[model samples]
Target chain A: MYSSLIITNNIHSWVLSLMPAAVTGITEMMMIAMIYLTVFAVLGLFLVLMERKVAAWFQLRIGPNRVGFFGMFQTIADALKLLSKELTGTDKADKFLYNLAPYFLIISSLMALAVFPFSENLQAFDINIGIFFLIAISSIGVIGVLLGGWSSNNKFALIGAMRSGVQTISYELSVGLSLLTMILLTGSLQLSEIIEVQKSGWLIVQGHIPAVIAFMIYMISGTAETNRAPFDMVEAESELGAGFHTEYSGMKFAYFFLAEFINMFIIAAIGTTVFFGGWLSPFGITESIPWLGVFWFLLKAFALVFLMMWFRWTFPRLRVDQLLTLEWKYLLPINLFNIVLMAIIVWLNFTIQF
Target chain B: MSYFSDIYHGIQTLLTGMGVTGKYFLNSRKGAITQQYPDNRDTLKMFERFRGEVVMPHDENNEHSCTGCQKCEIACPNGSIEIIWDRQVDPETGKKKKMIDKHIYHFGMCTQCGLCVDACPSDAIKWAPNFENAVYDRSQLTRVLNKPGSKVRAGVE
Candidate 1:
């Protein structure tokens, strides 16, 4: 089934064949990086606009509509505003780590984007341990948050960073455990392999209750991991005034902002790929139209993203103690039991595998 | 058993909260409370008594009912209204008939208090609710109520 729809691989080889083998690798790498960066920039603007629009709709207000048609270019105008803004830093701030923080965040998210098997052939790099690589790389962004907050010399920034660090570290465990439960069903760590297994049926449908439970856990922790609302103590702007990136201004702030949206896209993309079946049309409805895979993938991802936005507007921000207790008391214990339950189910070959 | 029920109850409450927002998200057309100001400017109507600004009402003949009493001028808390009165001999009565030469309304300073409207004895001044009062210059904000060469309406002395 997967063999016929491998056009990107062929195009890649054909391009490589035209150039010398030595420079081909470098050229191809540069080409991939350029394309990914372009996608990342456009996607960042779009996600921000979508978030604001969703937020407005929930509050019964019209969001941006003054810029381009339906405020399509509002984010672009915002990007321009950020570009021309003056960079400001605290007088007593450490400059080196402060600057490097944004890069650490952006680079990690970018690296994770490379591993996702969008339409099988559309993947930039198909690593064997794709899920492991994703989990590992995605965690690096929190260090950036930590560094940015601590180096700023602002008390609020430090507190926000520490809160973010704790939230992310704890939530990551739930995210990983939930993913591991799915991994048991799929019998592989590679994202493509995971999606391929879903051809019979999506993992959520195959494993029934456990898969659904894992999915719920994944979504919650993923929200926390991204430091989005309800779990957005990291940048509780109302409380801490811009959180870890409090002192950052101009393009430095934009970098942090854009990286946040990109991280959100990454989490949604992963959720779509793992539980929802990346690039795989529902019930294999559009199976014949190979290019429609991208559409399917984006549709599922955007739906999940919208769900996150809904969560943001509906739930009030939890207190610090409540946030910690919610994780340690509820999600962690549930996830642990869920993993054990999944192990038993898998051992008994109880999954509805096709 | 209570712990399991508690989790179930928690999930139920969360879903209920989501349902409220989801209804709004889906029924946005029915739920939208925003009045798109610029697009609906032509259709937008203000309340008759909104008190956006004070204006001296003039009839089709460009004749007004102002007796130049300076009552509105005296009543204005912000001193936003100025009545420039000119005395002239009436064609019929041949007595000094006090007429308003100009009813200057400085909108920039006016707080839309409706005091001037309330104080007008001849019912000359009233509230106009056309709230889009923005202009490029401060001079444009100070408006003359009477049309040029217009006189007081008959039988309202």
Candidate 2:
């Protein structure tokens, strides 16, 4: 059955080759979608182990070191445990929404994986509106959070859901604005096209002062969107307990947990695509060393993940009011100013040869 | 002032922050702040004054200095001590005497307060450094100090 699908897809690609650019684009997009689902399932396993190890290092303790060599297979064991355990739902919960929330969360975040370019020709989709699709798909995760909280019929869960809703929506503006500056500079929303623009230099270096400011804004906003530490008031143990998924048990809880780590990877992957030049090597170095682009891409993504972990361990959770105020007062204004500065730089083509 | 001065000031602040982190990172490799309990058992050391389980010292002749005076039994606040006596006819004195047949001590109830050791007039008992007293069965914790055939000495009392 799968072999038939692959043959059909290849045939479709060949047929579209004769059409104009528009039909070929649709065929490429379908191939990208198929690859995205397969890669992300494998990536989720690695991410779970990485998050646990990172958490352990920050707290000065050893975590999950018994299953396999250096505890590599610990996540697999945990998944087995979750699978065998009975999933129990609370009597008070909205059963349908409670069960549906995890599926929504996982599907939406996984959808964002479509636009991430792993290498020069490795993108799942080369949509001209890739950034817009990414931002739109990413916000759908908040719907799952809200549903999970509200359906659980738990006060803490509801509060957590509400906090996540407010936090994600607020941070989205700054993240969108920051990416807008990049979109303006590249004059394209397609991730592959953005990489083409960065063939000579990464945006962080080439876009200069405004690019640096935009990168900072993007990092902070992305961290908030993932509900990472300092901004992780939603799942704050002392305050909202386990937050929106408080009533979920066994495999259902595991689904929510898995979605969180996947969300982290998605944020880091998108950030890499935008500011660090996706799969493009700096100064056109990949021409001599073709694999250098993938190496550079992974290096940047992992560094961003490490920074997120560092922020979680280092800072205290912000008070609800403080978090909102920082978003509105500080992040929004700085991002707006950054956009104006970027427009000036692009207009002057300051360092670019027209 | 100038853009170059602003850049220099930023670098100075960054270096100051990095310096503090560098000092602590270098110091951490010397030794961990907490001790590993099971791994370092041989070199495990505690304060000299730490009180552990009580032990009765026996001489080369297998004779303990306890007179069976029942002082420890009385001194124990928790009733953790028991003394059983056997009447024996002394060879030298030609009289029946009460000899300590068994000295049973229930360590499960022992708090290691050192009161019983201080209360004993003969100074036969002292604290032993065997703090790993955990056992599978609670009954095994009630120890019998005096062996089955052992008896108190003659005349020393």
User: DockQ for each of the predicted structures, in order?
Assistant: 0.54, 0.15
**lDDT per residue as tens, model 1, A133-222:** 999999999999999999999999999999998999988898888998899988899888898899998988888888899999999999
Fnat per model, in the order shown: 0.69, 0.00
Give me the runs in candidate 2 sitting further than 4 Å from their true place.
A1-35, A289-292, A351-354, B1-132, B143-157
Q: What's the true lDDT of residue B52 in model 1?
A: 80
Candidate 1, CAPRI quality class derived from DockQ: medium
Question: Can you list the residue pairs that collide in candidate 2?
Answer: none
Model 2, A80-158: lDDT tens per residue?
8988998887888898999999999988988887667776655555688989898899899999999999998999999
Query: Which regions of candidate 1 deviate over 4 angstroms?
Result: A1-19, B1-5, B47-51, B54-127, B135-157
Candidate 2 lDDT, B6-96, residue by residue in tens: 5467447645654554444345445334456688799988657777788887766677777788899999999888887777787788888
Clashing pairs in 1: none
lDDT per prediction?
0.88, 0.79
